[model samples]
Each structure stands twice: as structure tokens, then as C-alpha cells.
Target chain A: MEEGKGEVKHMLLAKFKEEVSEQQIEDCIKQYANLVNLIPSMKSFRWGRDVSQENLHQGITHVFESTFESTQGVAEYLSHPDHEAYGNILRPLLEKAITVDYHPTPVQL
Target chain B: MEEGKGEVKHMLLAKFKEEVSEQQIEDCIKQYANLVNLIPSMKSFRWGRDVSQENLHQGITHVFESTFESTQGVAEYLSHPDHEAYGNILRPLLEKAITVDYHPTPVQL
Candidate 1:
């Protein structure tokens, strides 16, 4: 975790289209993981398919979490060509999507 | 960033009650953060308030992300006494809440 550098998190929660297979979702996630390696402004990226049967998710079935150096980093990631390409591939498969971004302050217990 | 240990992510996104002040929300987030330091199974925890005016979020105001060693680690964190206490404080303040948990797989683009 990088401290005091205006760290921000970008998160996505989505449900896949009924026709989208599990393997396709895995492929899409891998594509996103690869973007982290290529994007210097992205501090960290992790994604996963929902494995829980819990009611708390309200139908959300997958999640992607990424930490960027700052809001600017977030903008750069959003506009990056690779991200655009990935989004094109992902959009059709997403039945529903929600995104949230925030600046993370250190939590001192 | 632990590898090959059945890493799982737990995420929460919520909107606060109409009367809940921003400071109260921040305080609640800090309490949750402190639990990370106390819980042996919680590998990492980070949180922030939604800074975007983007329509994508659909009213969700905050997010919390935590990584655990495995599903068991997640169960342990959920059942911890500190978590229960914190939830009691949080539940009343939340107008809406959504949680998602998943086992993260490495994305090999």
C-alpha cells in the first residue's frame, strides 16, 4: 500500500449475461489482470468471480478491484487503449454493472 | 499479494442513512480498519468514500475491500467478536448495503 500519494480505488461489480460461460468470464478477467502489468499508473489489480451463495450480494456475481496512484491514474487507466479494447469485449457479456471510486484514507484503529 | 493460498476478496458498498453525517461514516470505516490489524486471518484491508459524481455508482457512497487467506479466513473474520460489534454500529446507519465475496484467480492475459 503506497501511503500519502493520493491513493484511490476503482471497483466494479457485475452480473454476467446468461449466455456467457464461466470460461469466457475467466478469460475476460485474465485480460484485465494483464492490463495491470502494462499500466504503470495502476498500483494493484485483482478480480474474482462470486463464489458465495449469500444474499448480501443482491445478484452481483463478479468483482474487480484496482488501486491507482491517484484520480489522474484512474483517468489514464480509463482512457488507455487496452482498457478500451477490454471493455468492448466485456460490455456485451455484462448484464448489469456498478462502479465506485474513492480516495482511500489510512485507517488507524 | 499472496500467491497460491486460496486468496479471497470481500467487498462492501453502501449508502448511509439520510441523517448519518460524513464524520460518523468515517469513524465507522476506521473501526472496521482497526479490525484488520486485530484479525489474524485478514491479510489486507482498505476502504474509502465515493469521490465520483459518476452515474455508474447508483448511489453507493463508500467501499471496503479486504483480502483473506481463504474462505476459512473470511469465515473467521465474519465471526470475530470485533466484527459483530462493528456491524451493530454499522447496520443502523446504513440505508443500503451490498456485499460480495469471491476466490480470486490469477489473470494470465
Candidate 2:
């Protein structure tokens, strides 16, 4: 593992309260879609809500996938006010979650 | 398209500068491993740097995999000072990156 170098992925998962309104849900979905799609290094993106009666994917509010060139790449994305605004909007119902950051060590070199 | 609910995955890709040293590398890897592994709902985890000779994963510092029950679930993870401290240590060499939040909408009710 080199000292100041390596690839890293930030993975996050979140939940919301049960009494959320429909209008707020619509707004969040629309806004989040546009935001994730607009990033330059976002290789791909996906999102949706948990609606399983059996609760197979229970309690999950959203799932996203996007890749950046470097840790700085993620910083740039997080710095956008647009992103912050959405976080503010969704801040109310957020429940339990996790975010892990890591990078691989050089194998052959 | 539900209004205020869905499963979301926060994914991030990062890059760092090329001048990193070895001790810092040890510090980050050990700490990050413990953090990610300790989360309660953490289903799975992965991390690594971009070291492919063919440059397949170029510029990527880390890649992590984890699932949360809700947006709120993620909040708990981010609020911890331990996580934040690592970010502080890692703040210097971080280069470029992107973080996408998403969820799988419940289909069958």
C-alpha cells in the first residue's frame, strides 16, 4: 500500500421516517436523479425506494452508485451547493446509516 | 415514484496525489478497516487502490460496499467523530472523487 495514493470508494446507506408525505417524496426523487446524472465522473447511477410488503429490501430509502477519478473527485461533488440543499431537504427523516472510505494497495508495483 | 421513501446507496470514488509516504498508508488502512468492519448493519465491505497495470482502475483511491436500512441510517454513520477524524487525516492528499446516493424503490406491495 503506497502512502499518499490509492483508489477509494465511499459507500453509504440511509433510512427515513414512516410518515413521509408524497409530495416531498416526488421532489426528492426528481432532484436526486438530476443531480447524480449530472456529475462528470459518475460512471453509472441507480436509485429507488423500499416498497416490499415482505420487507425484503426493508427500511432502505435510497441506493446510489457513482465513481470518481480520485478522493478529490468526491470532494468536488460534495462541495456543490445543489448537493447540500438536497441533503438539507432530506435531513428530517434520515434514520440509521453508514459511510466507509477505503483504497487498494499497489499489488505488483 | 413514491414521495418520501426509497432505498439509497451512497457510492464514492476517490483519487489522491502521487507523493504519499508509507507510514500514513499504514495508518489509514488499519483505521479504515476497523471502522467499516464495525458498523452493525454493514452487510458487506470492500476497499482498494487503483493498481492495474492496464490502468483498468486508474485514479481510484478506494471502493467500498455497504447497505443501510434508510437515509437516517447513513446519518448515524457520518456523525461519529471516529469517521470524521479519518477524513481529517485523509483530507490532505485527496484528489478527485464523486459520491452518489440512491435506493431501490419497492416494486411489489
Candidate 3:
């Protein structure tokens, strides 16, 4: 981790292919979330389906966020064998995947 | 809020226009974060610039996240006068803005 940079978050905005069944998407989500168990460095995970009323999503429909203690930890999770295996099941189903990693800085009042 | 739904999070993926100065972007971020103070229902706010090595951000360079207690709370923040005022400053600086709101569900390991 860079000095003074805190927890890193990996956020994925997924727009699955229209032909991919809902069941397939559910399985993909489960596999993606279960990486927390398979990889020790992944601190936590959460996911959500897009429910925005504003039409500004640009076709991204689901958001998955994973937290890590450091950027190095995130690197580990990204390259872990289990993650690669999960990607095999996930990558084909996605029409587009937008990933962004960042060191979260809280805005205090 | 929906019957079983918990907190709602608003995630924004922003790619600023090339001509927008860094100082202008910083001012926009400060103004966006300060909305937490002006709006009663906005629970918390945080932001980060992308540092992903996988090169899948789809041109989104920054992510800003805001949390609300309920979906209605998010709606209140969306329609709030203060947020609209801030958007006037932020919208023009962006080349693309992807907004997503979701009810966060933790993935228990």
C-alpha cells in the first residue's frame, strides 16, 4: 500500500448480455461474492442491482464492490487462481464490465 | 424504503472532459462532498480516483459514493435543492456521468 492511502475498494459495474439467463447471472454473482472465502485478502463484499430512476447509468445494471485492506491485497485477489476460475464463468456472460479501484477517502462534515 | 430493503447507496462514475482543469475538478469534488452537510437524509459520502491496473474502467476516472438510510432518503437527496445546485457545477465539467442507486446487500462469507 502507498503511504497514507487507506482501504482500497474494487467496484465493478456489469451489464450482462441479454441472452444470458437470470439464473446464470445469479450463479455468477454468487461465485463473485464467494471470493471473500476463497481469498484471504478480500476483506468484504457486497452487491446490488441498479435501481436508479435517473437514466444516467449508461447501460450498467449491477454494481459489485469489494473492500481490501490495501492496494496490494486487491492485487492479490485479482490474480488469485479462484478469481481467475470465477472469471471463466463470468466473463462470457458480460456485455460490458467497468472496473474501478480506489483508495476511499471519507468526506467529513 | 421497500419492506426488506436496507440502506441505499448512490454511486457515480465520472469521466471529466479533457479541457476541465484539475483545480476545477477538485472544486467540484469538494462541492459534491459538502452536500452531506447540507442535506439531512444523506448519511455519508466518500470518493476516490481510479487506480485499477486491469484497464477496464471504460473511461470513468473517479467514483463518488453516497449512502442513505432508505430509498426514500435517497429520493429526498436526489430532489433536494442543494444537490441540484451542486449538479449545475458538476454536470458541465463531465464528459460522461454514470449514476447508479442500489439497495446494498452484504455477501456473507
Off by over 4 Å in 3: A1-4, B1-4
Residue-level lDDT for B106 in candidate 3: 77
Best by DockQ: 3
Give lDDT per model, in order: 0.79, 0.52, 0.84
Question: Scoring each candidate complex against the real one, what DockQ results?
Answer: 0.53, 0.12, 0.57
Error of 1 at A51 (Å): 3.0
| lDDT string, candidate 1, A1-109, tens digits | 3223487878888999999987897777777788888888887777776765347998888888787878888889888888888889999999999999877556655
Q: Candidate 2 regions off by >4 Å?
A: A1-109, B1-7, B21-27, B37-43, B50-59, B104-109
Q: Tens digits of per-residue lDDT for model 2 on B1-109?
A: 6433534444444566567665666565566556655665434334564433222333555543345677666666666676677668776766754444455442211
Better of 2 and 3 by lDDT: 3
Candidate with top TM-score is 3
Clashes (backbone N, CA, C under 3 Å), per candidate, total 0, 72, 0
lDDT of 1 by residue, B45-78 (tens): 8777786534789899877878787888888888
Please give the lDDT score at residue A14 for candidate 2.
Answer: 52
- In terms of lDDT, the poorest run of 10 residues in model 3 chain B is B1-10
What does DockQ come to for candidate 2? 0.12
